[model samples]
Target chain A: MPLQNIKVIAFDADDTLWVNETFFRKAEEDFCALLEGYMPKEEANKLLFDMEIGNLPLYGYGIKPFTLSLIEAAIVVSKGTMPIELVQKLIDIGKKMLEAPVELIDGIEITLKELSKKYRLVMATKGDLLDQERKLIKSGLEKYFHHIEIVSDKTEKHYKKLVKHLDIQENEFLMVGNSLKSDILPVLNIGAHAFHIPFHTTWAHEMIYEEINHPNFKSFTKASDLLQIL
Target chain B: MPLQNIKVIAFDADDTLWVNETFFRKAEEDFCALLEGYMPKEEANKLLFDMEIGNLPLYGYGIKPFTLSLIEAAIVVSKGTMPIELVQKLIDIGKKMLEAPVELIDGIEITLKELSKKYRLVMATKGDLLDQERKLIKSGLEKYFHHIEIVSDKTEKHYKKLVKHLDIQENEFLMVGNSLKSDILPVLNIGAHAFHIPFHTTWAHEMIYEEINHPNFKSFTKASDLLQIL
Candidate 1:
């Protein structure tokens, strides 16, 4: 009954709609292996994570920012002695990630297809505008949504703006995605319904230790499960 | 009478609303100076421009893309001989540019304030989402606009979508900006009014040698000049 008033459903792009974090995880492993000569794999990965968090305020989110942070972290881990070829390699890694195929989450297409008929669906992402737009088009799922909402970050304020832009009230909006920090918590805090259908892998940055228990919140393990309730 | 039906005036950010291209030009000079040992300043500048154009489809527009292109161009110019310190300098240069203060165009605040009273004002740009949002807030010009629209590029298709999103007819939308190619030409092609206020320094990439003469087009030398006719 809580979702009865929902007129718009916004789904987070990255891991929510496609296989994103798995690719990032693979990239991180490759990065750590590349820097193994300078630092241990675990240490180098941690350093890269710290570098990304430090740069987040300025760089926002995307493969490009991640690539930039990788270079910066390599510099620090290698003590400013990284070879030029290695730097070039890091740049290529970012581009390859950008060009990577969008592997749709299992059953996401049918889920979106079913929901589109009854609700105004939107793909919301806090990723690079061009990169996400490319993925949306590549996924062959653009036709399912009315439009895409790309934001720099998904904060409560941003959610409020998104709802206002949709010309709907907070209760009339529903957010479905993988990361609780980005797609669920802030949305739930804003008096809207947030249903979490988490991806198998989440970045350490998006991990939360606490369990979520909110009146406007629901949790599901797979995308297809949404149709059972919504 | 031509402008009578306009309800929303979307102003292009960057050089149109503030001092943007000047900063980029200065950054280019500094970048060339850093690579002077490997390539001539003129050649280095041209190479950087070429690198940017080549990467545009993948990277889109914004300081982040420009920064990434800078690093890529430096690698090619130096031919793998550039020291790690130089790469670090390029990274630092990008951060400094991102952190640079927003300098509003002369008399633009007054123009925006005056125009906001009678029309729905929107700040639209093809810049990074966070960067443009920061500039708008820093310029103290956010209050004058109804909302901000960030797009990957400004083409006729993009303008059409913007007008549709604003829930207005083509003629009811007006675009004002410094780049004739970006803000005026495509806008006119879409049957919307486009007012061009030339910025003193235009990016070589945005330069269009052909003069624009369209029924929906008008050119101005400064931002304040818009008040006279609109």
Candidate 2:
């Protein structure tokens, strides 16, 4: 059956609507390079990931927390001997990430514009508020969204609460995003329709090794592909 | 007359419901001490404040952004001569701030418990999403609030949007907080009632030098005072 009853269509802002994870990947490469004198590239990446996972409860997501984790990893790996200059360089990397231009994924504008005409479009993404708001404004896609929810995490409870707030029945809401862990599974778990548009580069944290098979779930390789599905 | 018609009563989380600004103040003192070798206390504070205001558009608010600003200020003030130990110390300061316990204001529990019986209680505060969520969970006051909004900033437009979301008319909503700039004036400007219970120490950014005179506005010296007014 077609998703004909869906009245609200929400899009994830990061990699789904725009280029995001790629920047993180790039930053990680530079971050690993900065700490090579203290540890191997593989060891540095593992330590940084461990720090990020451990800090999730307190620091949440975004470049700020990532930067902090990098510093912490540096200190731990280098046994507190990491140079001050290197720490300053890490801070600069974070600043550069924050200042990175908002590059919308291909066909996002056309897809959003088309989808907005038929449904109540909303932007649901998790990250630092100012950074996300800045990106939204830069994307110039705010006009298409009826509501924007910058949540801390995308848990099953959070999605349920969001659907309740939007006042739409679960079956009548659809979510589109790049991360199956964050964007797809939670909505699917709630019995809501979800579309996964895989990006070229996915963060290890966002990777889902398990297979997903749900009646309401769909996958697309491109944003424009959503046109045919919806 | 009485605020008997208020259907929804929202409180600002930081400073108003609990001790928040004091932590920031303490952190600022510690931050200044960390950089004392590089610049005078007064000069360091002025430069840090300037960096904070300048970085506001990029970093927004909260300890993460504040921490980043501190690093930037340190680099500029020290002319890149800042020691690695100092940078490490600054990171520690931020971690300490984040790990600080959520200390509720006097009589907040009773006030919220009593008020929750008669009105829909909500938490409306601006800051990092993760930090705010952690504080709310730690506060043990989450059960009292029906909804929690961790917004980017509290502007008149944002409040209007919130009231609309709650499906409450402006006259039937009341906002209580410590900052007149954030919690009081904006609500009053939108034809809503506001209560100001000032904290002992206020951030310079939150200070409102102008006089406020509104029929729907009230001020109190204690949280318990709210019980009598309501």
Candidate 3:
């Protein structure tokens, strides 16, 4: 069946807009290389991941300046293998992370420009507040969106707030992104239609979530290809 | 300050008890190299991430024999440049990913050994059922807990079902992992105390969810360090 009633189409900003994971992934590799003298990559990453996960409650998601976490993780993993250079290396990675310009996803602008005409296109992404806004504004894609929802979480509260903020009906909305946990599944749970467009190299964290067994949820292989359903 | 009423502790398997992201991340690096011959690393990754984000509704986590996705992506990124050797290279990377072993986090065995003395200790992880179960069983760490809850997702319904399967109380359960999106956040929502042990180089697909902002949710840098709280 055609997915109609999707009056509000929300897009995830990170991988959906540009690239998010690989940049961080590259920085992490560099971080590990710098720490190779003190600890093996596997040991060092385990420690780093432990610290990052533990600190999520305090730092939230994208608001987290991961450089600090990277430094702290180095110290923890070093276990007194103490080194000053590693901390500096993490700082360098952070600079690279922020200074990196946004790279638009293939066919994203073309699809958005086209979809905006037929639907009330809104950007519903979850990430650090300023960074996401910066990306949207810098890409010049911000103006086309009727509403922009940048949230740390995409729980029911996050979705409900977006619905209210945008004055949208849950049934008339569609959320798209790579994350089943954050995008399709949750949106489907709330009586909204979600068109999942998964990315490659699915994060282990995002990998844990399962597909929704529902009538409303749908999926596509590419952003431009989503036009048929839209 | 003490974690109370906790009888059973469940751990997310993939990167929780063991190291998996590193291999995946490494595989991604190799995959990108293979694709770069046809498309820029940036463009190749953007397309891969985009395609991955699209598959969540269809695949739903556990690094599904993702060779199909990788092959499909390479051809798309090639835009007619895909050569047989490159396809073979991509297959080789996919094979490496499939063969990557689950290396446990340092000190996990020691810590879990201690925790198992006081708690029921279930491995509440999700993945390819056989793969997840195999990783656990082969690790020789499978005998530590009384329960093993392996499934595709861990929503309220999933958690509730697992709890029923294990016959545990709401206040007595704890979920631990590197992703707040999966391991920490959902458990907290369902009236349980979750331990967020963040991992650097977490999977990109993992939803970077917001905090519960509730009192019962919790986190720690080291599993051994959890002793201080208890």
Q: Which candidate is the best by lDDT?
A: 1
**Tens digit of lDDT per residue, candidate 2, span A106-191?**
99999999889999999998877778878898999989998788778999999998898788899999999999999999999999
Q: Which runs in model 2 stand beyond 4 Å of their true positions?
A: A77-79, B2-5
Candidate 1 chain B worst ten-residue window by lDDT: B210-219
Query: Compared with the true structure, what per-residue lDDT tens digits does model 3 show for residues A44-152?
Result: 7777777777755434455233654675676666664544444445555765675678888777898899899988888876565445656787888987787555554
Give per-residue CA lDDT, model 1, range A1-230, as digits (tens).
77889999999999888999988899999999999999999999999999999999999999989999989999999998889999999999999999998898999999999999999999899998889888999999999998889887899999999999999999999999999899999998999999998888889989988899999999999999999988
Please report how far candidate 3 places residue B140 from its true position, in Å: 49
Candidate 2 recovers a fraction of native contacts equal to: 0.61
Can you list the residue pairs that collide in candidate 1?
Answer: none
Q: What value does the interface RMSD of model 2 take?
A: 2.0
| Best TM-score among the predictions, by candidate number | 1
For each candidate, give its TM-score against the true structure. 0.99, 0.94, 0.49
By DockQ, is 2 or 3 better? Answer: 2
Give the range where candidate 1 chain A is weakest over 10 consecutive residues by summed lDDT. A145-154
TM-score of 2: 0.94
Reference-based lDDT, residue A117, model 3: 91
List DockQ for all candidates: 0.83, 0.61, 0.01
List ranges where model 1 is wrong by over 4 Å: none
